[model samples]
Target: MVKYVEGSFNEDYIQTLGVNFMDKKVQIKSTNITFLIWDLGGEKEFINMLPLVSNDAVAILFMFDLTRKSTLNSIKDWYRQVRGFNKSAIPFLVGTKYDEFVELDFQDQEEITQQALRFGKAMKLPVIFCSTSHSINVQKIFKVILAKAFGVKLVLDEIVNVGEPILVYK
Candidate 1:
């Protein structure tokens, strides 16, 4: 997402070790909004940084790796911890690595999709599947966040079919 907002992509992978910050200004529905992004590292050791990240946040992205189902299981714990600090923070269930996810077998894809949908429904969050490398549904994440935050209906259509990037927010 940092790359997407920055309008560039890097081939090399540099994992977030602790926390990183990036700011971007965008025009959505003719409204210019500035977004201050905090990229907290996703590691048990970095869980201590939750208070700093979750405090006063408008939205919380509970993201998991689509290729790794175990990551999805961790979402429950993360969401619970974040909710402790900010119950009103809008939550989003995000599945990353769609480029690799679509390459998996149909059964695997269906299983993951069903599980993600169930989890999203349970949390009452908008579910979105995206590939940062491919820029698929990357910008839509923030756009949906803004629309929901301001109670505005998005004009974009959602794609929910299997074997495709899923964007379910109704």
Candidate 2:
């Protein structure tokens, strides 16, 4: 999120081993909004904290590693748990590490992309593919979230293709 707010990428960001709290003020049109972000590593020990973050959330972003199919598979369980807490929260399905994902073979990329689209369609979640290291689609993700949360129409074209950074907002 530092990359989103500060416009500088950090190579030394460690994964959240536990809950981390953050907030950022952003302008959507003429409105000033402060977003409270709570991060919890998807560890068994921290599953109990899910409700704290999920409850009353404007949106819930479920992210997976593009290079790891196992990470994608685990999202279903996380989705289910989060839904039990706040069903009205707009859900976003994101595939991270697209910079490394593009280095994979063509067939693997196609498979992951198709699987992510299928999951996004099934869950009615906006699917976004991004790379934090390269700052791809990072700001767009928040824009989409704001547009959805505020019931504003987003006019960005969806990128639908294999082996490309997807920003499916439909």
Candidate 3:
């Protein structure tokens, strides 16, 4: 993971490029399915530093607490910002706290879901609501992203076997 902190412009976050070794090594006869994952800054002040959104990104994962309607509502502006940056219409949407929503008011829940649906329709992207704390549908999120980005069909044969090894080409 490479951390980029362009402090002068109030933007700071980490970006990582790697392969999911848990799955087979792509079995590629020629090239690797390389990827770039940008874990962007969530701070309001840092939002401005995002580079122009474009198709270079495979997906954008917007995560927010399900118990906080305010936070959920805030995603719209962020979505616009991201959409503007991502001019190519790559897949993107909100990821809510699935389990945490049990504690939120019913009205808030409906509103959030409505907002999510509205945003999804407007952006032509699907909204994923899942919980990481309880490990609910966590793995599926990556699967959806992978399917959308690569247009490849994948099923869970088994958990991917990830190891630490650096490949060298002569």
Candidate 4:
């Protein structure tokens, strides 16, 4: 998961087998605010540690596989657990594996997208469809987190003029 956020695409990685959690201190490029990111595995054994890790979270991101409906259904349970720990934490619903999802039929794609939208609406959280393999919306997700955490307006410079130098002020 950290590799995904950091823009490393390795599809051959194996799934996590146990209740493992890792933390990394990352600096948001847009805001320059250092954030401690706790990547928790979604295993039953990790349920007990939710409160301990999420107590100081500014934002919580619940990601599910777009090609799997069951993963989407599990978001409710995850959201509930996170909210129990920190009601004030901003929540984000992320649909991953978008590269695979696009290969599905139009009807299937629309159905999954609609379902995800409904869940996001019901949870009152923003939804993002991303493909780490294709580097889609990966950075945007963190930018949204930074904006929400610090109440800052984010204007992403998607394209810069050749001669114009970009500057980031502290």
Candidate 5:
């Protein structure tokens, strides 16, 4: 997750280095809040550091792969771990790889969405479907997180003026 945000997308998924965790400072655009982002590795060895890293997070983003059901199932454990550290941490359930999920059949897509929706409702957390490769809903996810964390409303360009003209010809 940190790698993706740091603009390194072409790297391999496997962890070759010995680094278990990383921290980066990220400034949310149009706002003064700067998040000290922590990317914790999921390896069993790094599990012990969860309490140290997750305890201070303002918002926790639990990301799962849309194409991988196991990843979705693992969210329960992740949520429990994060909550164990800091119950006040606002958590957001995110489903990644929307671009790949689009190639799947309707039944598969529906099943995943329904399952995620049920889980989100049960957890009382907002759910988002996004794709880093396609840049789908990536910014919106942060905007929502910022809003939830700090009660700041982002100015969206998509808001339409109802009384505005459709076209202007000179």
Candidate 6:
């Protein structure tokens, strides 16, 4: 996945090039298209550290565990807050775990999925289900984001196709 600094420039910011500088403070590049990814720490204590989101943010990928109904419940409020901060109707929604769904309690899974679908309609965002551990549709997530970012369509040719052009750095 891509990584970038969350806040404004500081003394810690460094300049470098290519894969050799993977650990640089800020790294920017393009495979098929340029990605200005911002990595925000998922810590409750860092609530005050809201990074400045650009007007051109084509998508907002909100991820959560499908087994956790509590987290899914909070998505609506989070969507509300994000909408308040960003008036743009960017494509944004929850991404649930794919493989873990079968292992989770049936009630929790159903409840979260139902809530997600409801909020998705209310917020007009597309909910993308994924599993990073099994590599299940993880790349598709980026493809959706990039397609939305560029305003295009992603076509699938076969049952397990990575679309027409698979541009993966790793």
- lDDT of every predicted structure (CA atoms): 0.89, 0.90, 0.52, 0.71, 0.68, 0.50
lDDT string, candidate 4, 65-89, tens digits: 8889889888899898888889998
Q: Which candidate is the best by lDDT?
A: 2
Sort by lDDT, top down from the best: 2, 1, 4, 5, 3, 6
Candidate 3 lDDT over 37-145, as tens digits, reads 5555566766655553233665666666666767667777787777777755456554545666756666766676676666666667666665555555554566666
Off by over 4 Å in 6: 2-32, 53-56, 156-170
Q: Model 1 compared with the native: what TM-score?
A: 0.95
C-alpha displacement of 29 in model 5, angstroms?
Answer: 9.3
TM-score of decoy 6: 0.65
Against the true structure, what is every candidate's RMSD? 1.2, 1.0, 11.5, 7.3, 8.2, 9.7
Query: In TM-score terms, which candidate is top?
Result: 2
Clashing pairs in 4: none
Q: Over the stretch 1-170, how does candidate 1's per-residue lDDT look in tens digits?
A: 57666867677869889888888887878988888788888899999999998898899898899999999999999999999999998999999999999999999999999999999999999999998888899889988999998898888887778888999987
The deviation in Å at residue 3 for candidate 4 is 3.3
Q: Is candidate 2 or 4 superior in TM-score?
A: 2
Residue-level lDDT tens digits of model 6 in 1-170: 32221223233533222211112132113434555554443334433433344234556665566667676666665566556656674655545455777576667556656666666677676666665555665656666666665666666332211111111111
Cα shift from native, residue 60, model 6 (Å): 0.9
Instruction: After the best TM-score superposition of candidate 3, give how far the Cα of residue 101 lies from its true spot, in angstroms.
Output: 0.7
Name model 2 segments beyond 4 Å from true: none
Let me know the TM-score candidate 4 reaches against the reference structure: 0.80
Write the residue-wise lDDT of candidate 5 on 36-102 in tens digits.
6666665557677788778888888787888888889989988887898899988888888778887
Candidate 3 global CA lDDT score: 0.52
- Between prediction 2 and prediction 4, the one with superior lDDT is 2
Number of residue pairs clashing in candidate 2, backbone atoms closer than 3 angstroms, sequence gap of 3 or more or interchain: 0
The backbone clash count of each candidate, in order, is: 0, 0, 5, 0, 0, 0
